[model samples]
Target: MVRLIAFDLEGTLVKSVSGWVELHKKFGTWEKGKEYAEAFFSGEIDYATWARLDASLWKGHTKDEILEWVNSVEYMDGAQELIEFLKKNGFKIAILSSGLMCLAKRVSEELGVDYVYANELIFDKAGRITGEVNPVVDFQGKGAILRKLKDELKPELSVAVGDGYNDISMFKEADVAIAINPHEGVEGDHNVESLYEVKEIIEELTRGQ
Candidate 1:
């Protein structure tokens, strides 16, 4: 009896491996961004500091410019079909990601998702990036958020689908954890090759419920 489904944005719903990395490449800041990422992974800087450092790299860019880059990101194959199937079956859809909010909001709106949670880049009064961010989702904070949502939504069962290590926390919180084309070493209750397979898995899970 799955009543809610949570998805990871980058690599899960979208074809991009990382919206942050893509933006860094687009803005010509990948080298620096890579350093920050390494620092975060090596236990040097914290997630907030890493995010701030990454956001600072895009300081002075217009919001429209960033939006344009976001729009360029393509959806994963069968993303639309899978989402439509979930909606048609009356499941609440949520996107919980540590990625940028611009892409999350875009995907949520286009797919008609019920809930979205992601980090947001702050901007100045002139609509330019201000090197600041509101870190709503941390790399390992997805479980806590999902726990809160479970209390609030009171769903009979909740499912989570993702493709990265950051999604493992989310997997722990879900009644059903699905890893779709997951990164190496990432595991879940089920492993799927694509979103089409994800739809099939869900269908079988809910077949008699």
Candidate 2:
């Protein structure tokens, strides 16, 4: 029996604009921007420089503008039904994301999930985005957070469902990891594309005594 059902936010549950894409669109894709940010996540660049570069990306945009962009995001089809069914089955649901907390919070509210954990976007006094989250959970750090949750909850069975490498971390601790492929170039163990199929998989996986 799966007692806990955890999910990834962006790319997994919804198709929101990615921070990298948004920043690149605004800042003209400075190779340094992508390279250094990648390096910082990979531990090549220190935290301070990463913060400075990230802040520069949204230097002019106000918080309201960012929220507007997020409001336009589209959800994975059948995402709502899947969450409701799981809840009816007595499973505790949580969203674990490597994306921005601002967007994750919106997804959580839309889906009515029990909890959400994601990197926060810092703001300046003028309410402009100051920088990306410090210690962001992009790759391996995602798995670390999952492991921590597993230890804390110790659910009878923990299942993770997601659509990207960031979701791969769920495998570190979850009893089962259902990978959904909603975008090209992303690979998963299950490779499901629809939320209805995901609901069926969960039902099948939990069937029988």
Candidate 3:
């Protein structure tokens, strides 16, 4: 029976405009930026260099400006209802994201979820973008945290839901993996196009309803 449900923040529960992507679209081709970005995220380059390049994309934007831009992000359809259902059913809900903590905290408070695991963006006292993320969590690192949570909770079963390549990494540690209308590929253990559909999967997975 599934007992805990973990979700990815961006492109899963809530989706916000990509600050760096927006900059690239305004100044140049997004593909050009993504080519280098993919490599950086894949570990071909150091995180510091990646931060420098990512920051350069924004040029002179203030950290608050960026946060405000993201604050307007919209949650996926049925996201609120799904969270409510999980909570009502006595399941542990966690937001597992690779997003900035500032934005993550905002979303967490809005959704009133239990726990949040994400990265932190560094800003100067002036609240200007410093172009650095503290302890960026991506790739296989997510699985490590989920595994630890599973051990601690000792739940009958653990589940993870998301729609990005990075999210698929948690499959090994989760009892069930759900891919929700993935923006890139359909390689998750199970795939769906709607949050309501995901709720059904969870309902069926849970042992006594």
Q: Which one wins on lDDT?
A: 1
Count of residue pairs whose backbone atoms collide, per candidate: 0, 0, 0
- RMSD to the hidden true structure, all candidates: 1.1, 2.9, 2.9
Evaluation by lDDT, superior candidate among 1 and 3: 1
Clashing pairs in 3: none
The segments of candidate 2 whose C-alpha lies over 4 angstroms from its true place after superposition are 26-32, 37-43, 46-52, 182-189
Give the per-residue lDDT of model 1 (tens digit) for 60-136: 99899989988888999999999999988879999999999999999999999999999999989999999999999
Cα lDDT computed for each candidate against the true fold: 0.92, 0.73, 0.74
Q: In model 3, which runs have C-alpha deviations exceeding 4 angstroms? A: 17-32, 41-43, 46-49, 56-60, 183-185, 207-209
Scored by lDDT, model 1 comes in at 0.92
Q: Pick the candidate with the highest TM-score.
A: 1
| C-alpha lDDT of residue 103 in model 3 | 70
Better of 1 and 2 by TM-score: 1
Candidate 1: list runs displaced more than 4 Å: none
Which of 1 and 2 is the better model by lDDT? Answer: 1
lDDT at 151, model 3: 84
TM-score of each: 0.97, 0.83, 0.84
